[model samples]
Target: MHAISVRRVRRSLPRAALALVLAALGAALGPGAAPAAAAGHAEECSTEAGPYQKTVERHLKLTVDGVQSAADCAAIRTLQTRHGMEPATGRAGPETWRIVQYERAVADPSALTGCPHGTRLIVCVDLHRQLLWVWDGDHVATGPVPIRTGKSGYATRTGEHRIYERVEKQWSELYEGPMPFSQFFDGGQALHASYRNIWEEPGSHGCVNLRYDDAKRLWQGLRLNDPVYVWGTRGP
Candidate 1:
């Protein structure tokens, strides 16, 4: 019985040591250790070819073959991560392709010619491209970022408007949804952050939905009474 007890202690020593080591490492790494590890694991590229593989490859200037190569995955994944797209699995999916189109549109927001330029900061929403940019007179101060506006019946109001309300965290009783960084520019419609995928269809109820990060940054930059210019029509 004594020998058996000794053997059990010996067997547990290694596990105890491992637990100590892991605890020390966790302490050193801080709270983000688990997520960082998971993110690193998630960074592994997907092997299957996505539906828009060839289109994404062409846009990224990669080989136009519709195959999912390691190199292709890395490049596509980089763009996806940079733009805060989800999964970021290096898959050339619809979301990835949409971001590519958005980047192209951002390259020349001036071409839209609808956003008025002046010294005052103006939040410009181009429904045609589903993009928003902050124009500080002739030059863009921020954005040209992707946005999700209202759907068919609940179209985002066009023409000029001003941000009359700014709520850091808002809950809408009308829709029973949380609107973070809500910047009301027109009536019930506002520019706010959405937890849902910005690309999700049917769309917001007349609010201009932005990514969490984008909406936070925008909230920080603008104040009450800032002008918001919305134009064109929502693209299919």
Candidate 2:
């Protein structure tokens, strides 16, 4: 198996200053957690539709300001509803802006690639862009991952560590759904994937999350000795 290496995005996960939830327990959900949906076919940021839906919503919330028009409010509701977030007071006040701030956290990916199956070597995930990158030497494959991070006020914890272990089908009273728990340094953070609404959002509890498919791909490829780099939210 080829060894995949990478220089992760310089940014780290969120510290106490503004921590958000990247991935964790599904918590209180009755039976099963929502499955990880397709990313490309689903919603995204845009003024059009489909994968661009999230982008459209973000644009409406941030760019189009002023009175609470039915369309504007509906857009806000769509954003809040999809992410399992609370509605913006039904009035689109400060909470709306808060969502916008978190939405802006996503940054361009640094690098990514995948190794052969037998290698089972190291894997790296960056919390900043919500992207899961698997590397084999200098080559890697990056999948656009979505997560449910803490809202405006709260942010996910961030730091640097190596991946030593992983758990599958882990249930949680804190998470919104079933998640794969990853073992880092603190035993507090994880590297599971998350789906925010129909579109992918940079939201999570306090873990460095990945898309279910991306995690699955990495899960099968990663070995205990692989490297894992994490830090705070991406900067402006």
Best by lDDT: 1
| Candidate 2 weakest lDDT stretch, 10 residues | 1-10
TM-score of 1: 0.65
Across 31-88, the per-residue lDDT of candidate 1 in tens digits comes to 8573233312344689989998998899899999899999999999999878766557
Model 2 CA deviation exceeding 4 Å by range? 1-122, 141-157, 173-177, 181-185, 195-202, 232-236
Clashes of 1: 1
| Backbone atom clashes (below 3 Å) for every candidate | 1, 48
TM-score of each: 0.65, 0.43
Taking the tens digit of each residue's C-alpha lDDT, what string does model 2 give over 150-206? 334445555445665566665444443555534343344556544323122334445
- Model 1 worst lDDT run, 10 consecutive residues: 1-10
* Clash pairs (backbone) in predicted model 1: 118-137
